[model samples]
Each structure stands twice: as C-alpha cells, then as structure tokens.
Target: MKILIIEDEKDMLQNMQDTLVKQGYIVESASDLDSAISKVGVYDYDCILLDINLPDGSGMDILNFLKKNDKTEGVIIVSARNSLDDRIRGLNTGADDYIAKPFHMAELNARVKALLRRKNFEGSDLLKIGNLCIDSEKHTSTTQHGEMELNRKEFDILTYLATNQDRLVSKSALAEHVWGDHIDQADNFEFIYSQIKNLRKKLKEVKADIEIKAVYGIGYKLTLS
Candidate 1:
C-alpha cells in the first residue's frame, strides 16, 4: 500500500517514513502544507499520516480539500496537540484516526494497518476473491495451489487491483499508486504493462481463479475467472 506523511519535523518525518517503508509500504512524505496539498492533489494513497501543525499553514486545509474532493484515502491525524477539542475537531473534519506525538512506531504501524483494513479490505487483513486469498498485513497471497511467488511491484499491483476488483483502473492511477513519487520521472506507462504482463503469467501458473484483464488503451481490471 501507499502512504503519505504530512509533517514538519524533519526527524519525525524521516522516522515515520523509514518505519512504514520497513513494514513493506510504499511511502511518500511532505514537510509542509504546500507540498502536502501538491501530493494529495495528484496521487492516491492507502493511508495518510497528517500533522495539524505545519511550517507554512494548517493541515486542516488539506483535510478539507480531501473531503471536498471526495477522495477515498484513509486519514490518520498524527498531531502533537492531544487536546479533547482538537481531537474532536479533527474527527469531525474527516480524519479516521488520531495519534499524538511521542508515540511508538509499532502503534503507529498498527493504526495504519487497521485503517487500511477497514477502508480497503472490509475491516479484515485477508481479501478473499474466489480461490485467492491475500493477506494485507503479511503482504502475501495464497491460492488453492498454495502460496504464490511475486516480486514487490507485482504484489503491489495485484493488491491494488484486487482492492478495486471489477473496476477499471487507469494506467496512470496504477503507476502513481504503486510507484508513488518516483512515477514523475517516467515518460510513459510501459513499466505498468510489463508488471501486469508478468503478474498475469504468475497468476496463470498458479491456476488462480482471478484474472487481470486489460482494456486496451484504457487500463486493467481484476475479475473472477
């Protein structure tokens, strides 16, 4: 999954990013409100870790922007302000969870995983589609044939598609979600096609009951075979 960290403290930002990356999530970050808005404007994320205080502006605007735009990304406020009023304001504004500063990375990771499960997997770590079972927390998938072998990108792609099963996913959105900030450096979406092709081959090998079907010039969708 992809995560966006909106924070001002350089040390805390780096710590959060590193911790989540170690947990096998594609992580991106912005240190201030402007950069945070810019990122949220472009890409889609599974979860967002937001700090209400920023060097330039309030992070509340970002939350409002997300709500106004109807973006589906789960948001967790990670602010230093732990006041009852502040927590209430954040939740009322559209945050899914809240955690104060000076927190354990483990707890933060747990919150992230919980939010992702609720938002994407129907409050469970396992996404069961046909004979395929994907454990989001473990970052692994199994079929009736047993566990399937997939590289990082392939797994990310499969997970994203599975979450949006039966829906057509645009190539650009897939690239942005899976590759995060790095997709800006690419000139085309050839890499997405390549990854999908390889994932299809692996799915076929395992005799998985799911199929990723391409829509020619559009993108792809995952459906039960």
Candidate 2:
C-alpha cells in the first residue's frame, strides 16, 4: 500500500511516515498545501493522511481538488481542530475518516487499515477471487492447495493489480503505485517486469484462480480464470 502524509509539523510528519512505513506502506509527505496539491496531482495513493491546518491554505480545499480530479484515494482528516463542524465538513467534503491530534499511533494505523480494507476489498480484509484468497493485512495469499508469501515489491504489485482487477493498468501507473519516488530513478520498466514475473510464478505455484495478463504495448490486467 502507498500513503501520502500531508502535515505541517515536521515531527508529526516524520512520525507518521515512520510508523506507516514500518507497517509496510510506501509513504511520502508534503508539508504544505501547494506541495500537497502537486503530489496529489502526479501520484495515486491508497490513503492520504491530511492535516486540516497547513502553512499555506486549508486542507479542506485539497479535499475538493481530490474530488474534482476523480481520484479514488481514501482520505483521512488528521487535524488538531477538534470542532464538530470541522469533522462534519471534512466528512461532508469526502473524507473517509477523521483523527484528532494527540491521537495514538495504533488508532491511526487501525483506521488506515480499515479504510484500505473498505476501499480495496469492499470492507473485507480478504480479497477473494474464485478459490484464491489474499489477506493484505497479513501479507499472505492462499489457494485450495496451500499458502504463499510474496516479497514486498511482488506483494505490492499483486495488490495494485487486484485493486484495479480487470482494468488495464499502464506501466507508469503501476510503477508509481508500487515504486513511488524510486520510479523516477528507474530508466526502464525492467524492475516492474521482474517483479510481475516473480509474482506470476508464485500465484501459479499456489494454483491461484487469477492471472496477471500483459496487454502488449500497453499494460497488464488482472484476469480471473
């Protein structure tokens, strides 16, 4: 999973990034509104942890930008502003959840996981495709025959493809989602192909019901048998 943390406090931002990264998410940050808007425009994230107050403008406005752009990334308002009106406005404006400042990191992590589960798997932790089952939280998958474990990048690739399902995911989008900042440094898609190849082999080894089908000259799609 990938997360973008939009927070102004340096300590808080670093803390959130560290915690989420430890929890196995690709995390990035923006300390102000402009940077946040720019990042949101260029990249897609599984979840965005947004602080209501920023150095430049209200995070509420960024919510509008996200909605207008039709980005499906889940938003969780993490604000020191504990006003009911602020909470209502954030949710009304399209936030998936809200967290007040001085909150426990455990609670924040739980909310993020719950939001991802709801967004990606329709409120279920288990992503079921035919006889195959994937549990994102546990980072494991299983078939009728047995269970399988994928490395970080391979698991990320599988999760990204599963989120898009049958939709053809372009190489650029897949790279951004899985590789994040490192995607810019990669001169070619050799890494993506390598990871997908490994992931495919593992799925086949486990007798998975789904396949990652390449759409020659375009992208790859997740197809169920």
Best by lDDT: 1
lDDT of 2 by residue, 67-101 (tens): 99998889999999999999999999999999999
TM-score per candidate: 0.96, 0.97
lDDT of 1 by residue, 168-216 (tens): 9998889888888788788889989899989988888888999999999
| Candidate 1 residue runs with Cα over 4 Å from true position | none
lDDT of 1 at 48: 93
Superposed Cα deviation of residue 84, candidate 2 (Å): 0.5
Error of 2 at 187 (Å): 1.0
CA lDDT of each prediction against the hidden true structure = 0.91, 0.90
Model 2 Cα shift for residue 30 (angstroms): 0.1
Cα deviation of 135, candidate 1, in Å: 0.8
Supply every candidate's count of residue pairs whose N, Cα or C atoms clash at under 3 angstroms.
0, 0
- Among all candidates shown, the one with the greatest TM-score: 2
